[model samples]
Target: MSDQPVHIIANFTVQDAAKYREYEKGFFPILKKHGGEFITFDDSSVTFEGTAPPQGRVVIFKFPTEDAATSWYNDPDYQSLSEHRRAGTTLNFLTMVHSLPPRN
Candidate 1:
């Protein structure tokens, strides 16, 4: 694993809670399989200054390394389960960001 962690940020609106729930139930196992860890999730986020703040649910997660994060995203099981999310929600954005290096 690299010293730098990778973070996944997702913003979405659930259209079908039941189907989305199914996706949620299956997400964690695949994430852990590839060294990913859940960070936090917020259904309501207050934006202090941004012109465009994320609407609906915002989720954040981290992985030991970028490779681990990417692998988890592309894993076959995850892809299969993602269908439920796709079918049940409007995904605004899903992005990966690398952690900043430590400052001297």
Candidate 2:
């Protein structure tokens, strides 16, 4: 966290609605195991905007340290579930960003 925050942006392909929901069941638990938090989700309906549906799913989680982020990404449980996510959808781009430290 570095007294700031780590930001992540992941855009993905979700063709089946039911499968996506099922993936969540596996995902949310793994994330919680790694101390992850659910900040914002696409509300299961991306059509809220003209952007379109199945634009992909987005998630936001915070960690107190970069290592925690690394751990979460590399955890075995997540690794197993990640295979499902990868098989089910296409992840266009996933990024990790850390905010600039605040001025004293």
Candidate 3:
């Protein structure tokens, strides 16, 4: 994979608030363990042009490298934690975007 930074865009709608909250509470520590950084999240994000906007929540975060991003996702603890998210939310997508290479 490219060494470029990778950004994650996750969109979901909460179905069970308490279960989703459980996921959120444990997310940060695992993210940081793999060099991830939370950028921002929006409950009401505007989409000027798109096939369609996501459901309820739009989240953005980044990792220093694609490997880091993948590692975070593949981590067993993260996978376990995501069970609560799966039970709590209707996930639209969790997408990865690569940053442009440094200008020569």
Candidate 4:
């Protein structure tokens, strides 16, 4: 397996839990298209370090390739579904590599 890692961090608000479910449903196909993995994650981000009450959900995913992730995001199908994610929540995101220490 490649040592490179694609880490995705998303902090966005969902108008309602039901809406979130809908968004998640629509989100699955796109993610699957890129052969991404649904790693362990949580939504109970009640507070932030030295910040006010958080107002959104937290999501993390590992993509095998940056191109794959980008393609999945820019895909015409996902382009529109992405709007729902934005509409339902305040999106805060960060995408980067792990850059772990060189394996001995």
Candidate 5:
């Protein structure tokens, strides 16, 4: 795996609480399986610069490398679990950001 770290930033609006909870319950194990870590999530975030803050929640998670993040996203088990999320929420964005190179 590459040394570079990657982060997934998911912004979504929950439409069905029960189904979203089911997706949340199943997320961690799949994340761990692919060497990913849950960073944080914000439901009440403010946007200082943007015209409007995100509609709902913003979730952040990290992986040791980009490949690991992609693997987790593409995993069949995770995909199955993601169906719950899809059914329960409207995702505005699920972006992957690469960490900057370490300072020399």
Candidate 6:
């Protein structure tokens, strides 16, 4: 797999705070396990020029590599934890963006 860093952007509206909190409690551990870093999140995101701006909370996180990000998402524990998120929130998208390759 390529060593390029990968960023994940997620948009979702929390419908059940308790359930979402349950997912959050286990998120960092799983993320750290796969070398992922939480960047930032915005509850009130503004749209400048985009036609389809995210409707709810916007979160951004990064991983050292695409493989790491993929592994994090595919991990059994993470998948199990995500059930809470799926039940508690309306997910818009969980997109993966690849960083530019090294300028050799």
TM-score of each: 0.92, 0.73, 0.97, 0.74, 0.94, 0.95
**What would the per-residue lDDT of candidate 1 be over residues 1-104, giving only the tens digit for each residue?**
55799899999999999999999999999999999999999999888885765478999999988889989989999999999999999999999998987799
Runs with alpha carbons beyond 4 Å of true place in candidate 5:
none
Specify the highest-lDDT model's number.
Answer: 3
Instruction: Compute the lDDT of residue 18 as modeled in candidate 6.
Output: 100
Q: Is candidate 1 or candidate 6 better by lDDT?
A: 6
- As for candidate 6, its clashing pairs are none
Model 6: CA > 4 A from native: none
Among all windows of 10 consecutive residues in model 6, the one with the lowest summed lDDT is 46-55
Residue 48's C-alpha lDDT in candidate 3?
75
Q: What would the TM-score be for candidate 1 when compared with the true structure?
A: 0.92
Question: On TM-score, who's better, 4 or 6?
Answer: 6
Going through the candidates in order, what is the number of backbone clashes in each?
A: 0, 1, 0, 2, 0, 0
The better candidate by TM-score, 4 or 5, is: 5
- By the TM-score metric, which is better: model 1 or model 5? 5
**Residues 17-98, model 5: lDDT tens digits:** 9999999999999999999999999998788886864579999999999999999999999999999999999999999999
lDDT value for candidate 5? 0.94
| Higher-ranked by TM-score: 1 or 3 | 3
Candidate 4 lDDT over 1-104, as tens digits, reads: 34465766776666766655767888877888887776655667655457744655677787776777777778998887776666667666645555464679
lDDT of 2 by residue, 51-74 (tens): 553456776666655666778889
Q: What lDDT would each prediction earn against the true structure?
A: 0.92, 0.69, 0.96, 0.69, 0.94, 0.95
lDDT of 3 at 34: 100
Q: Candidate 1 deviates by what RMSD?
A: 1.7
